[model samples]
Target: MSGSDSAAATSRYSAFLFDMDGTILNSIAAAERIWGVWALRHGLDVASFLPTIHGARAVDTVARLALPGVDPEQEAIGITLAEIADVEGIVEISGAADFLRSLPADKWAVVTSAPRDLAARRMKAAGIPVPAVLVTAEDVAAGKPHPDGYLLAASKLNVDARDCLVFEDAAVGIAAGEAAGATVMVVTATHFHPLASPHPSINSYETMFTEIDSDGLMLLQERGA
Candidate 1:
């Protein structure tokens, strides 16, 4: 990690919050394949539409499009089923599995825009452990770009949202983390394009290390320090 990344390292957090898809795992290929088919069926330009959906609930994304004769809720349900059925391209982000395993199970949570079943299936396929506190779309009335999920995850972990470090990959997820008052770390392991953000950013967890102090506060830093 560079000196510019020290902002996140300087904090002692009680818990860690993570966004699933682009943060800990890469589901973009499978997701875009399915969504592409749906987009073409709806007369949308696949190339342009796919990028807008990451880090957001499928229902929320679909509802925002306002496609004629489309019921957002039903479309989202179908998309979820397809995603669950196809984990062909799903894989962990660089060092994600080992990094997650190192954390105290109760001190971290996954707050995702995906539904619970789909999230579980993807984590299993990627060989990442399903976290103890997994907050899914169904658990919150609203999704990313709203602080509801992250805040709820912190609540479930018995910690303050401000005392957690959030790992996210998309603009919406980052917004959600910040809105929840958590320190945000941008994970770009699965990014398809460059992202510019003021928050500390890392492409992989390979060189990152974590320590838990006597008071149970967790600190994340580059290895070999």
Candidate 2:
């Protein structure tokens, strides 16, 4: 194996809960398909709009697509529906399925910004099982950056928030996990700048992460011991 590949395989962690989009699945293709439609309908250039939508929830996605005349909440539903229908480009995250299957299911679950329908469609398209506990947009009164979703996931797992480890690709999701009293792990899907919006920059486990796996995902962090 190559030097870089060697370092990746040796990475380790204790317990892990992975995020679906961007983190464990490459959803840009399907997301782009839906967002592109939003951009065109709003007269905005698709390229310019894609970056801003990376970490946003459906309400945020819809709000941005709404522009001035449209109601953001109403438009978010359309975007959500369009996304569910546009499952053409959805795929599992890099090394995500293998890593997930390699680990025990009771120790992990998926926490997503996408609503139930969209999450189901994408998971099916990506050939990944629907996580035992799905904390979708419908589950949380507020999405990421609010901590509700992460908190609920940990609670459902019967694990203390501080004992849970979260694998998130978005700054908001990371913030949510951290805020919910859990250890937050940042998967380097994009440059740090996007995540630079918040979250303390972490290089080691210290008080932040118990340990991160080869893929930058935290594992075994939620152990009760």
Q: What TM-score against the true fold does each predicted structure earn?
A: 0.97, 0.75
Q: lDDT, candidate 1, residue 70?
A: 94
lDDT of 1 by residue, 1-225 (tens): 542667698789999999999999999999999999999999999999999999999999999998888999999999999999999989999899999999999899999999999999999999999999999999999888999999999999999999999999999999999999999999988876778788888888898878899999999978775
Judged by lDDT against the true structure, how good is candidate 1? Answer: 0.93
Candidate 1 to native Cα RMSD, angstroms: 1.1
* Cα lDDT over the full model 2: 0.67
Model 1 alpha-carbon drift over 4 Å, by segment: 2-5
Candidate 1: worst-modelled 10 consecutive residues by lDDT: 1-10
List all candidate RMSDs to the true structure: 1.1, 7.3
